[model samples]
Every structure is written in structure tokens, then in C-alpha cells.
Target: MLTQYHIEMNREALGEHFSERALQIITTANINQDRLAGQFGHDEYHFDNNAIDKGNRYINEQRGYILATLIGAGVSPSVAWSAFGRLLHSAQDFYAHSNYVTLWLDENNASSSALEIDPLTKSILLSPKLHTGKVYFPMDVVYFIKPLRSFALKLLPKDSHGWMNLDSPEQGFKFDYAIRAAVKRTKHEFELLQKLLTPEMLAKFVDK
Candidate 1:
């Protein structure tokens, strides 16, 4: 149930609730990535699907999972506005810092991103405050997720947290191994999400 018009959600409130919600979804999905991947194309839970387009196949599933999790958690339909806001803020920043990513998108019109830190994932890794630029064989969508792709594209590549370029096989395998780690890790921009939730959204999501 949505609150009356008198109710309001400030950014801080939204961030907290959103963080909680994101964590909830990430956790639930991590437990079931293999089953979910079967729905997509029989490929188990991989962060990147070589068979499908990068931003299209992978991020779409992540977004779908996030949305369904919210609904299952009883998020009021009204919360979508706040979620979109978070997506825009997080994805744009990641892209701006990844220069090689931008050039790849420009060259090929599409790109593939893997959880493993191959040349592909390394090119788009959102670098820590540094000025290095990166480029790939052909410009690709994974390179420019935000302006070029759907808002959900911001939250995907859920494999291998910390940096997009995960250094080892173990690290890559565990990329977003659990949702709480993904949502509550305190490093990624999901940190900026708002947590303010109405009594209704709160009651609904209390399970996690």
C-alpha cells in the first residue's frame, strides 16, 4: 500500500531503503542464479552471456531479478521512481571513469563483458580515481551501458565485485556471490541508494 500524498521520501531515506532492497534482491538471486540462467538460455548463472548481447542479455536479467524481488518483498509500485534515480546516478559515474569502455562502444556499437578479468572486462572496469583511458577491438554496449542501454544496465555485470576486472578465477567465480555483499559491500555506488521506505514498503520487505 502506498502512503497518502502527505508522505514523502527524502534522498537519505530512499538510499537506506534502496540499499536494503538491493541487498535483499541480490541475496535471493545469488542463491538461484543457476536456475534463473536456465530460464534465459540454459546457461547457468554467468555474469556475462557470450551467446547473448552483453548489456541486453545480462543486465536485463539482473534488472528483472531486482524488480521481481522488490515486488515479492512487497515494495509499493510507487518505488520505481526512486529506483530509476539510483540507476542513473550509479551507471553514469562508472562509465565516465572507464575510458577504454567509451572507445569500445564507439567502435563496434556493441561489446561483451565477462566477470573474468580478461581484456574485455579490464577495458570497461570502472577505474579508481585515475586518468587512464581504455579501448577495445570494437566499440560495444558493455562499454557504454548507461546512455546507450536501459537504466537496468547500470546494476548488472553482477559477477566479480570490487572492480569490473576481477583478478583471479576464484574472485570472478564469486562475483556478487551473495546479494548482501553486493548491496551492502559499501564500496560500489549502490552505497548511494536511498533507504527511506513507507510503512507499506517496509512491512512488505521486512522478511530480508
Candidate 2:
């Protein structure tokens, strides 16, 4: 997902439940994941290159950290929210960066306008055909070299992130579906976090 969408979706998902400070911290961390060195190559961070098991492990690890930070004494609030944001980034990217959306459409025999289909309903995670866009040289590396970027993309396979991403509206109607999935996934991540948080901890974590 793009940085702006990450910010927008995270805020939309949790803005009402979290304080302004918590939202800021979370949003900052979410954006930083895209900026930080080596993160782009970390398939677990963006669910890129079909690192499914690694992605799941990363999410679980962050969940544990968020719980520990919230329930354990002396951990910084920023630490918890940071983990929260990182987790959301990967979860959100699952929709935008993977063939899951196409698979969903195929299963339902629907088009991009099929917004009525619940984004989270299908258990396509274990599908043998389910895979994310592969990231590779010249294709992703030359992204900053605008004129050559298109040429570079042509060299990438159909399964490459360059061809598969629904990061923006320009991608097509499927971008809308990705946006919806990402927003809902953000909320779902929060709810999953809540399961680990005590009532008192949850209250302390979110704004009243």
C-alpha cells in the first residue's frame, strides 16, 4: 500500500478508539516501515514475494510485543503502538500486494464492482495458487528513475509487484476492493489485539 493510504486507513480504522497521541505514534511507525532501510526487501513487512509463513510469524511476534508492552510494567506506550502499526502494514499489504483479490474474484465469479463480497470471508491463505508479487532488481530498484521505470516493469514477470500492485486508484477498480480490505484488516488487527488486552489495559491503551 502507499504511505498516504496507510495513514488514512489506520486513522479511519482506529481514530475513534485511540487518543491523538497514540494515533500519531502508530501512523508514524506505519509510514516509517516503508522508509526504513532493508524493510523493502523484508517480505514479511509487506507480504511481498510470497513469504507467507514469515509474514504470519512477524504478525504474531508484533502481537506478542503489543500485549507485553501494554500489560507489562515500564514499557513505553510508543513501543506498543509502533508494533501495532507495523502489524497493520503487513496485514493491509496482504490485500494490495497479493493475488488474493483476484483469487477472491475468481472464487465468487465476480468483478471489481463486487464490493458486496466480504473481503475477509474467504480462507484463501492456504491456497496453492495464492502468492504475492515478487520484488526484484531493475523492476523495483529503478522505480525512482521514472522514464525507465515503465521499461523496467516490462521486463518483470506478470507476477512481479510492478504489475500486480493495487496501491493507487490508477491501478483499476480492484484498487477500491484493496482499500476496503485494508481498512477492515486494520480494524481486525485492533480487535485481535484487544483479545490479548485486559479490560483495564485496553482502556488505558485507547482514548476514553
* lDDT to native, each model: 0.32, 0.82
Residue 51 error for model 1, in Å? 4.5
What shift in Å separates residue 6 of candidate 2 from its native position after superposition?
0.4
Worst 10 residues of 2 by lDDT: 111-120
Writing each residue's lDDT as its tens digit, candidate 1 over 126-188 gives 334312222221232243443543333343443212234221233333232222122222223
Task: Give the Cα error of residue 60 in candidate 2, in Å.
Answer: 0.7
lDDT of 2 by residue, 91-184 (tens): 8888999987888888776754644545575478778888898887766777547688688777888888888888888789888888888888
Cα TM-score per model:
0.27, 0.93
Candidate 1 ranges beyond 4 A from true positions: 1-28, 34-40, 47-56, 68-208
Clashes of each: 26, 0
- After TM-score superposition, the amount by which residue 122's alpha carbon in candidate 2 deviates from its true location, in angstroms, is 4.3
RMSD of 1: 15.7
Top TM-score hit: 2
Model 2 TM-score relative to the real fold = 0.93
